[model samples]
Target: MGGIVLVNVPTSKPLPIMTDTLQPMLRMLWFLLHGILPLAAEATYLIATYYSDDVCSSSYAYQVHAVDVVNCTSLTCSNGEMSSTSRSGDVESTECSTDYVANMTSTLSDSSYIIVLRFEDNNCSTLYYGYGTTELGECVENKYQGGYSISTLNKDGSADLEHFTDSSCSVAYASETANSSAVATHECSSSKYVWYTGSAQEFASNSNGDAGTSFSSDGDVGTSSLGSSHNMNRGGEYDFPPPSRDSSSSDARALTLVSVVFSCIVFVLVAVIIVLYRRLNRQTPVETRSGLWDDDTITATRIPRTKISIKKLLCRGAFGEVYSGVFNRQQVAVKMLLPATRSNLQHVNEFLTEAKMTAMMDHPHIVYYVGVAWDSLSDLCVVLEFMEGGDLRTLLNKYEAERHPVGIDRQKATIALHICHALTYLHSLSSPVIHRDLKSRNVLLNHSMTAKLTDFGISRERLDRTMTAGVGTSLWMAPEVMLGERYGVKADIFSLGVVLSELDVHTLPYAQVKKQCRETEGPRARLWS
Candidate 1:
């Protein structure tokens, strides 16, 4: 009866029609807000959190439900986010569960709030969740809920069961997932364990031994764990931080103080030593001569000065040419290195090495290295103790020509003894030395026929036993050396034995059927044994 009595309706749409239109429009806006806007908001939050440190720490709290609270015990915070410390005794209401993760994060926003929480169960395990600030709001949740079947688990990959859902619902919350799931897991019978990162102090103690108690105060994020009892002794378990100061400024001060103290002590000690040394030295006899001809410089084994000068050339080798000279106004032999071939590294190194090694070895039995002179632009000159008798090979040749012969047995034994002593000294050096080129020419004799081992032109300290080099004269080379074997000190011993045989027999060990040196040869190059 009321519908029949209704007056003619206006041409405009009914109020219910307008209401329906607004309902659908509102729903579209709701879709944009709850679905699209929420997704866009989450994306922006992540971007903002990544660039900021405080936001990073705050974001981690949303991953778990309420657990972090004041004076936190059993609560965990990572990257700075926290949770409500108090537990919900019995969370039986499903309506409450809808916002369980949300309420937890909202409570952790306070600076004074220290405690955080995590969830774990027999069938399904829940982990820590934290909150981040959104552009639309300050503290916001980043979680959802779903469950995954344990049977569908992958072997090579891993899954994080962040949130659970009713049978009607589908998946877990994105906010609850870790930034990285690739972290290595150690397997137990029914579970895999992951490392729970700890504070900077704890991390430093565990990460490296050198970390020690010395630490920086920058508050960099770090991770370390405690496996033993909570109140256990920290002796070896944890590393405590050292005293803090401005490192750069404090270090400079410490270094300056140490330097000043050291310098003062050194100056006093040196002054005292100098005074004592001068007093002691003055008491001794004053030698009129101070140059190379002094008794200290020239020994009884030294040869007399020769009349010949640098105008006449004595001889020449691949690296150097020898001439006579007056060193410290006393007659001496000078060997001058030739300008090397531009591409010849071996020749250059050999020349420089010989001068350095000879200068270091100051012995009467060894050839005297009087002085060395060189510049970047010029070739090097090495001054030596003049050999009046010349080389052994030359003396032997002269004896053969003349009717009068030298005393062979006595001369040989003297040379042998002197060489053995020199070799022993070189072998016992801190770094064992090797005379790679051992030949008759390198064996020099004074007027008295006492041999002075000379020419370390190609010598090198045996860094280890084996060197990646093929060195030594062909005639005097040992079996191992000739074959380019990884020879040791034994190789030198073998070479020395060959030299002894040569001196006795005046012939090579392999002279009967000498094998021509070839590129490819085995360790058994010579069968002298």
Candidate 2:
């Protein structure tokens, strides 16, 4: 008698092996695959196919399967998909089932393929499975580790994610809505959660728009049922999870870092511009010889040169010092070039130009230009009506400090109207004037709260559509001016709107826009907007 001696072999493996009752059968299959049997053929390519009821489309039951007879294919289901695929190298027919939402057929050869990815999305709504046959023996990748998709927002804390041994996903097959925020892992070979099966129609209707809404390009899940415009697969959904932070977190962190860096760089640039402007204003004696005070337009407003008894010093600028003084036995604010910048032609020219323009304007809402007086270039000064209430920004601060809550009132409206009156007169001229630097800082008020528009050095006479751009405070600048587009009188109108807002809120325009930008783009977005 010819008796074959047989050894009883036990399957031993590592801790995290996908090994169980099927291990013996897998071993036999592995042996059959390693040229052990003449009946076994060498598998050249890999393919996966699945049929789903709710293939991430509609709430109806329909069959959608993707077959790749040409190359690698990945099939994804809206609900949990768990159907073992036939290992044959050819496309095999699968009986359409209404009870199961996931039915996958795969031609998986022994781990000798390229791009073997089988992982679920971070949300676990879609599962990506299959191996690539584009280039065999080039690379080996296995993506399936743990977890499943199709996570609905569980307002409650519990998540009952279980599969059924039966075909249906109703109460009889252990179907649940998963009332937790987190996605639960799917157990492909566990006793409690036997196999993944759920109602696509029920899940889609109950997903609350939080459906695991991704599918494979190689195949579709609920496309036939979900005949919507969202049928096309989005870009970059074919890759695996990054080794570190996920895409959203990584992108947020990158954006925040960029915003911070850009903000710092902008702050530095603005500081440098301020420094350069001051330095440029303090010019050398060579540039001061440009006959700044000799200009006929400026000397036309000259008064008898007299000594000014400086009462007290007000604010100081790069070019001059402002002082509350008496001019011709009347209260007035005297603007005198700083002793250091007296010889600076740029400073003298700017002071004279402003004086000339102010003297020409005659309106109660405009700052009164007293007269131009000077003994020599060193003593050159411009006298104007002294505003007891100081600048509008300062007055507003004082009101805020006194806990004076500002509301819509006639007083506020009158002040804004006064500024508007001044603007209307300037624009009504033959060649309309554009107050490019209009802001609360440039608007002065007297004791009775009567406002006046001042500081017209940057103002321009617009003869045509042509005009300079980006000449106003960024916070108060019009949209067109802020973008460096050619502006007209409409730019001043925009600044008036901002001043109105300041009166209403008693805050700087930058303060309000910065807060709003924080909720949207960065604070610098408005300046660039």
Each prediction's total of clashing residue pairs, residues at least 3 apart in sequence or on different chains, is 28, 11
What is the alpha-carbon lDDT of model 1 when measured against the actual structure? 0.44
What is the TM-score (0 to 1) of candidate 1?
Answer: 0.37
Alpha-carbon RMSD, candidate 2: 32.6
RMSD of each: 38.5, 32.6
Best by TM-score: 2
TM-score of each: 0.37, 0.43
**Residue 269 accuracy (lDDT) in model 1:** 51
Q: Write the per-residue lDDT of candidate 2 for residues 257-363, one digit (tens) a residue.
A: 55654565465456445545555576332443446466675667677766566576666543466788886788889888754456657777777887877877888
Instruction: Compute the lDDT of residue 354 as modeled in candidate 1.
Output: 69
Model 1 segments beyond 4 Å from truth?
1-309, 339-349, 399-408, 507-529
TM-score of 2: 0.43
Candidate 1 lDDT over 1-529, as tens digits, reads 1321434567665665334444554454445434332222111111111212323354332232232111112212223111111112211111122232233323333211111123332211232232222211112222211121111111222222222111111212211212223212211112212211123343335444433222223222111233221222333232211112234644554565556545654654564455456555665434466333233323322333332244434664444667777755677887765332212455544555566678778667788887655433244456788888887656544544464333447777777777778777777888988877766667788888888888887678999767756787666777777788777666666767766765665444454343343113542132221
